[model samples]
Target chain A: MASGGSGWRTLPPGGIIVEPGSSLRYKTGTWRVMRPIINQDKCVRCRMCWVYCPDAAIIETDEEYVDSKGRRWNRTYKVNYDYCKGCGICAEECPVNAIEMVPEVK
Target chain B: MMGSQPERFKSKFRGILDIPREERFVSGHRLCAGCPVGTVMRMLTKVAGKDSIIVNGTGCLEVSSTPYPYTSWMNPWIHVAFENTGAVASGVEAALKVLKAKGVLGKDVKVVAVAGDGGTFDIGLQSLSGMLERGHKVMYVLYDNEAYMNTGIQRSGATPWGAWTTTTPVGKKWKGEWRWKKDIMGIVLAHRVPYAATASPSHPMDMIRKFEKALYYTREGPTFVHVLIPCTTGWRFDPALSIKVARLAVETGIWVLYEVEKGKFRVTHKVRKRKPVREYLKLQGRFRHLTDDDIEYIQKIVDEEVDRINKMAGEEVIGPVEA
Candidate 1:
């Protein structure tokens, strides 16, 4: 609301509330809270964000976070939107940057 | 002492807010009584929490944390030498990748690298640049007390123009450092890392929220957070005035908090009205030697920097729509 630019079109209330992947828009970049989006294809399941997120935002089972081979991953990670503060930690700490912050529709 | 009364405690608190019961940094470690880095670290850990991999450079935080098999860190932490924490965090990310692949790590683990002004603006600049260039998913926090406080308060790149340091002292013939505070945040932004920000202990919530955003940039690759951690020892300010001095830094526009993403710039916190930089400088003993003319010059620099950032933030830049 604080002059966050005219081009920022508000999304319909019920539009899918996804994380604002790496592309966050706010006056301070600090003010921008992002949601996490896990790309299964690229995810290595490091779970760094799970351990690092100030708010416990990541969710994923160790079993589910496996590659093509039937091998368990080093860590399983996913974003829990309910508790996730939209802190980009999960996205920032992802070994592969697999987790991204996608914009959430208000 | 910050007594038990809540309102009185909060109002009297300096630099930033502290959420009791949340001991991110934990207790029982030693830092200098008036160390600026310690205060800033408290704020960062409070916001970053236990679910973070805190990579610290061999500075005050690292020294205090790793006192021969003891650590104050409540979070999963590591300490590499002075010039490579940024690089080491990159490797930590790589390891987490393998561990995550093996189903042994959590998605919530955030990676953060904390360094002093010397490490960030001078010695570690190259490694930080490399991390940014490669787009590593880490939040590199520069706790700037201006000079190299960890190493006897020598001058570093972050030392302000005409400020005194053991290395850059004022004399009858020469002023202090005699150069500008390197625009480290500005340099970080030029790399086009997904997120780059400047914060101060003055606004605890703001600083916390910034780290929140930094944590969320998982896919964006590389984020830099520069926090203005005022020094009581190095800057020669009263320990009690630390927070007040930090507030003055921003209020006077001597230290601006703004961010740039995809080349667009904007002011994160604006002081509707400007205050004289003199008021801010007058509080610090470091700048006590500054003549009115020197203060005027510094004031002009602050004003110009503010104006430039405001202009950039005003520009319109389109971003991806919410999925």
Candidate 2:
């Protein structure tokens, strides 16, 4: 149960989950010692990082991108730090080497 | 024709970049950092969408995704016992059918039952068989992490030959699991199921397409999709290498990706020149202890299976095995 909530007494009959996606309240951001940062200039918007992320932490942003070759990408990827455990699968799987795993300063 | 209405697009995956962005299997609860089961569930729910009820069997997917007071599932979900997931999913599918006929329920509700290899290949085989034989409209997905991971990597029937687990420890006299991995797809196919496919999270586009077909198409008996979920902690690999290892399994001949529909087998991801199984085996600590002879034995078994599957397809879907 989350903070300031009644314990077992207020639970649904037989403890059926009434609220969907209740796990959002429990943040897993602190679990990582390293964090992945995407290089905007280098990202080609291939979405390799987004598609390969096991945690679903890679978020597609409506940001504009233009590579050195004059190719344009309307959307790019960013990491959702709240749920990212820094597995670095995105970095490892990126075809362009756009993602880099940096030490979590905190 | 100018005034005509345009054709509506279904929820089909157009390409790798195109996918449903709905967060059905939301982040949280707790799964291992690089567990492909997470990716599997995410992609599955995305394909199945919101008008679905998920029946999860007891295993790591259940233990990690649905701890007390929270759940990673946004869709209607029920936690079934290890041995009765098929029964529950069948019941749910039946109930939905009756309710819809009686006008008690509205809209189409899809039923998807998910379980790890332990629950499906071993403990819950009977109920699963019953579900298939009865022809329920439930979609069954086997997330094969290759062992009972959450309870500490005990060997399951799905554990590969010569692979280490707590129960199948490497020793002087005893090797890893001696028995070959259970042929679940064959068993599923024997039920005369309409659509069944083997997939891996490494190939997300292909995986999602199979999930889509299993969830939406295939008009008859229960659909089964067996997916290999490479584990991080259990496999003892760098968490980031999860997808890479899964891809390697496909590139090598150890795990073949194919779909069998209406008794017809078709290879989905065909490797042109198959790599040696050692390239895949050497990465995971589970297969670290296999001797050269043992590795050769495994390779021989893979080559034989590939040839057999190739013969079944009547073409070289997978390339000839490499030495």
Candidate 3:
């Protein structure tokens, strides 16, 4: 494990960082102007939003829920607002018109 | 249960959650909204998998992802200077090979070097050429944003002609970028590497197939993939129109999708009814200053290039060769 060092003399070969996933502290969701609202009623649990999201903001949760139509769903999807940049790619890629990009109120 | 062949050919990625969640490049990085570079990075990382080490050059991808203490990479990653990504990857590959030969490392690992066009086409050409000639078992991917977007949109070697950049501004004396984009794929083919291809983020499956092919060629020698990534800020387009702009680039024959293996040329994605170049150029603000004559000039060039590629692929010439 290497710490912050001054020059190239103390750096590892090829500047390889031994630690991975060090970006957890940086919150990138503040850059979003639009947020995606997933309509569970229209969502077929198809995971289309999960795949097309460039930011990896869509998370698949094991906890199931019932939609407004009283339809039972197995797995649910949630947008990780802490990192989603709201590119609207998820909304555009949704085949069933489930995800809608609405202006961020806050 | 038997199904129709068309049903079998459906997208494998429809069940998106079924795709592996173990990401090599995670979120929270600072790439711009609707930046195709991020999408290309994600797709490449997904295809490369966990048994790989990524070597990134100093550019948008490097500066945005690894800001000092914070890094978005989940796999073993390295950040080298602009000109030496290929060199660094070569060193890493050598080290891994030595460790494996000594029985210290059990599993096989792949080395992938990623760089923007400014790093690859302009600054990093020497090291990239050397690495290719040396036949190192590394995959070099150049995400061609066509400009130095990280340092505020300057004209790069990969920038197409008549496109506005900070350096090549549209003025009375001169139109935006009077020169044509350099033929990087031709240069890579000149190296006579095992695999080389042109890809775009618009076609993910084609890009993924090329990535997998590059991975396969890692056992043979070096593999190079040039990807066209549309930049929303640099290209001066709506953020939502990124994918559409990229798709139009291919449809208009401006960026032909093709691959070269062992000196044989093949057109991967054929455009049946090629759209005119104006249709693609009209979408971006960068080409707003172009006159009808300028547009015609561009169309002529594109058509000639398409004819050349079709001839190489042994496909019937679809576009007019003579302007």
Per-residue alpha-carbon lDDT of candidate 2 for residues A2-106, written as tens digits (9 for 90 to 100): 234576666767877778998888888789878999988888788778777777788988878887778888997889899999998998999989889999895
Q: After superposition on all CA atoms, what RMSD does each candidate show versus the true structure?
A: 21.7, 4.4, 5.8
Write the residue-wise lDDT of candidate 2 on B154-273 in tens digits. 999999999899999999988989998989998998888878999999999989989988875434569999999889988889999999999999999788899876677889898889
lDDT of 1 by residue, B197-273 (tens): 88876666667667666665544688888888777777887554566678788877777777654455656786766
The number of clashing residue pairs in model 3 is: 0
DockQ values for all predictions? 0.01, 0.74, 0.50
Task: For model 3, state the Cα shift of residue A30 in Å.
Answer: 1.3
Alpha-carbon runs more than 4 Å astray in model 2: A1-6, A66-71, B1-11
For candidate 3, state the interface root-mean-square deviation in angstroms to 1 decimal. Answer: 2.0
lDDT of 3 at B73: 88
Ranking by TM-score: 2, 3, 1
Candidate 1: which stretches are off by over 4 Å? A1-106, B1-20, B315-323
